[model samples]
Target: MIVVERTFTVTATPGAVLGYLQDFANAQEWDPSARRTSRVGSGPIAPGAHWRHIRKMWGVTTELTYTLIAAEPDRLIFHGRSESATCTDLVVLHPVPGGTEVTYRMELELHGLAQLATPLLRGEFEKLATGGVTAVTAALDDLSRPAGLRRRLGAATPNRLPTPAEETGI
Candidate 1:
């Protein structure tokens, strides 16, 4: 088994960070090795939510089905399985004075003959982990920025009955 962990702080609330990370499909946005990721079914992002992820590393592509195994106000856990490997990812969030501190950890366990190469692959995996951490930090920083005027107004506005002109095409 190989594990990599990173901790970083961002100027986003813990709720905002957890909300963003809970959607596994967002991995594609921050994971350098991810080629594609899509949710299996869509309703709400909860513990049972799953995502199909295609990742390419060292020129070899692998597909994994990742399930949200656990979720809490300050933490999330995901389990991913592929033909040759199983991965567990844990994310923890803590509120800071001005933002949130996040800790991300990933553990990979190889099966069968693949385990033989685990030691040799550690360096490369470490590089990927570093890149992923940088990407995630950037993503969260962007998330903390205020939205554009239109977007802010859109979200603030409440739905109301259409104007009288819309009731009759004049």
Candidate 2:
């Protein structure tokens, strides 16, 4: 088994940060290793929420089915399984001075033929694990930046409610 962990603080309240992170589909938007993610079924997310994720690491892209094994306002856990590997992911959030402190960890277990290449795989997996949380931190930084600064930097469009005229198609 291989395990990786990371912790960081972001400029968002715990409630807000957990709300965003709980949407596993957002992994595609914020996680560099995640190439795509799609919800598997309709309904509110709960302990059984499922998602299909396509992730690339070590120059190989693979698909996995992830099930939300646990969910809470400040914690979330997911179990992902593929033909040759199982991954357990845990996320914990804590309130902090200016934002939330997030702890993310993942454990990977290899099986069958994959076990034979564990040495090579561990090295690559370490790379992915090391960089994963940093990707999330970068995303939060972008999201937490002031709107005016984002617009002036030409990185984002103005975030505002639509004008009444536009809303009314005038």
Best by TM-score: 1
Which digits, one per residue and each the tens of the lDDT, describe model 1 over residues 93-168? Answer: 9999989999999999989888998998788889998998888888787778877511221112112223336648
- Residue 21, model 1: lDDT of 95
Q: TM-score for all predictions? A: 0.86, 0.80
Q: Please report the TM-score between candidate 2 and the true structure.
A: 0.80
* lDDT of candidate 2 over 47-132, digit per residue (tens): 89888887887688878888999988889999999998899999999888988899999898989988888788777767776666
In candidate 2, stretches whose alpha carbon ends up further than 4 angstroms from where it belongs are: 143-170
Question: How many Å off is the CA of 31 in candidate 1?
Answer: 0.5
What TM-score number comes out for model 1?
0.86
Give the per-residue Cα lDDT of candidate 2 at 63: 80
Q: What is the lDDT of candidate 2?
A: 0.77
Off by over 4 Å in 1: 149-170
